[model samples]
Target: MTDDLPVLRGLLASGAPLTWVFTGDSITHGLIHTRGARNYVDHLHELIRGDAGRVQDTVVNTAITGWRADLILGDFARRVTHWRPDVVTLMIGTNDCTTQWLDPVIEVTAFAASITEVVRRARDDGGIPVLQTPPTVDLHHAPDRARIGEFAQAVREVAAREGVILVDQHAAFTAFSEGTGPGNDDMAWGLLDDAFHPNAAGHALLALGWADALGFDAVSSPVRTDLAARVAVARHPQWPPA
Candidate 1:
């Protein structure tokens, strides 16, 4: 078992209810591109509540659309602290990548520092922190956020430095897109709804990654989302950036 699995499993084994808080940007907000489909957090909710027998457990998404790491840090106490979560899942860096380039004050190092502080605060509140790297995007489609890979790396570095659990969604998605990873996901189908957010198909992979990290094996359940993906790609194959 990986070091991270035990931390989450121990909490479940404790026989007490688990309170999970998911915080980040739009992707974590699980809107727009989802097209009325359930996002990753929703899928995990079913698995945790249905399969894991944590029906009483509370899972909340405190993410705000278009928000950044620093914003989350600034509002940490209210968004995260008040809940006193047992497990905190953080996925960000998409917007931060753009602002780090366009905005004078926000840089990669500062982004990393802000993310690190978020994790630190979660830990301080007696919560287990899990860092999820933002999924890879079409660099051609989202040029302003081209440096997202660097920010994704920043998350990896922080997870290592903080010794927290990490779900490397960026790497996983890249491998699938490039035909390098197990399971036929990646670019064979349209994982992204557009340049900015993931559709239901993409969200499935996100949920799969989280379920794997937590030792749950809830398969993708986006039948309608899959059909939507087919139609989307047929209409615009290059929308996802090649």
Candidate 2:
């Protein structure tokens, strides 16, 4: 870890103003809650602004609920390329592991290829790519532990081969799920609601993992936002409504 600090520092100091594009399923989309600040992306935005001391950093959340890797890749060719973010983080595979698409090996391989392609395109267009393994879900409720593990492994392999950074969120979440440390609680496994989608606590855990992967000091402080305010601004009559 000591030896890696210099490299991390260098990456941080790079002249480019950091622009992160987060892509994935409902987690990335910030679902299971009302529109506005309740989602992870909003939490992430506040965290970055407070910790990094710069609100100029760009972040785009292109996540759609119930999306798979293939669907995400389809949009990558258009939306992602246009954004050209400095770093792209992906948190997918949950939807792919559903019973509707249970071919773990094939799905993992395809997902990995999609990620590789996105990275390659980013490089060609001048950008850095970072991949994140999906967080650990409630296996008791989801009943797809083996497939999830396989998907995580595939993400790691793809990241290595592509020379991109990989955040092993699955492993970290598992450590917490198994009662390893501070995050050792049922909420850490996103089981509070008996669903795979994480609650506020779960998203907070993810933000910490992201901070570590990005070589920033881990801070557990929560940055609360006014959901009504954000929604009001987003839905202003001057702008188009979703």
Candidate 3:
């Protein structure tokens, strides 16, 4: 048994390149930004490169706007098979929770099963699977917390049972937004204009949470000069106050 443990550790520590596949909805798709590069997936790439010092990591974002779990499962093999990622991060279920068509519990269960299947398939290819619970939306406006919470719990249960890592962004974001943690509510200013999709601040939070989950230190590099200029422009008003 002692030898077996070292053998397993050796297999896991072989220093292979890591490909991270991020799948979800519009938030994962990086909407409402001037460039197509303001989503959490992009931020995650930046953090990994900055901290890991030339790791062989690639992030493929396959999150389409308004997509539900069923839709994602239908296309999984075709879309996700080729990359053979080292880690796959899945954040879904918000849209499914919004639907009144299916039983919430059943929908969530089926979603969990579908996601588990994907993780298992990735395992067959030597990939690590991670689950990210959907973030809490401004439920006061739409008020789907009960259903969303159920779905989030289901995801967490699956992660635990499967021994996969789960990043509970739902809990993290709520704590941050409600003034209970290190989150910046003002950061939600333009990012969560509709409360569903996040702006830059929301993406930043995602990046930070992902870094924590991956056991990596937070990114310490100076912000890109061009990005800083854009952020500065966003902070200041236009000339003559259009």
Candidate 4:
């Protein structure tokens, strides 16, 4: 088993309730993109519960819409540490990288420090910290997608330096989108609700990524699939919306 898996496995083995907190921006909060539908965060909790008997895991989402790394840092104690989580996942940086050309260096430096502090705080609170790179933006233009990619790299650097579990969602989304065809544009559009937020289909792709990152193969559940399908169809009648 991977080093990261041991702690999670032990948590499951212990049979005690597990509290996991997911903190980030609108993505983690499931904004307009997932208003009435299930997002990655929702599916991830279910994915972890799986078929494990008596594994009661509570997932607390402290993410707010349009929150940047600095904003998150300011509210860390009240939103994150107060939950007393057993596992804490940090997935910020999307907002921090927007229009980064205006303050590229500051964005990089401040973003990195914010991520490092989040992980450090989680550790100090006796929670296992997991770092997730923010998924890419659909816009391929100058200050949008490329800069987000840069911030994703910053997240990777922090994960390595902090020695926390790294869930490379940015890379996973890129690969998943690339498999669709030639340029990354088409796949990027296919998954996004807007330039930034993910639709239900995009959320499913995210759930898959989180499962892979956690070293757990997801079991298809008819209940969850049906719920997702109903929501997807209701949102957009088009069969292959994504």
TM-score order, best first, reads 1, 4, 2, 3
* 49: Cα error in model 4, Å: 4.1
Cα TM-score per model: 0.84, 0.76, 0.75, 0.82
**Tens digits of per-residue lDDT for model 2, 1-242:** 33223544575676445777888888778776432335667767777766565467888898888787777777876557678776677888887766544544346667678777877776676667777888776666577544777888888888877777777888866665443234334334332233577655556556666766776554444452332233223221221114
lDDT of each: 0.79, 0.65, 0.65, 0.73
Pick by lDDT: 3 or 4, better one: 4
- On lDDT, the stronger of 1 and 2 is 1
Best-fitting candidate, scored by TM-score: 1
Candidate number of the best lDDT = 1
User: lDDT tens digits, residues 50-143, model 4?
Assistant: 6433357788888998787778778889778899999888888777887743455446888898888887888889898888888877664434
lDDT of 1 at 68: 87
What are the root-mean-square deviations of the candidates from the true structure over C-alphas? 4.8, 8.9, 6.1, 4.1
Q: Which parts of model 1 are misplaced by more than 4 Å? A: 1-4, 99-102, 180-189, 218-242
lDDT by residue for model 1 (99-217), tens: 43455646889999998899889989989899999988776567788788899999999988878888999986676555423433444335777776887777877877777776665
Clash tally, candidates in order: 2, 0, 1, 0
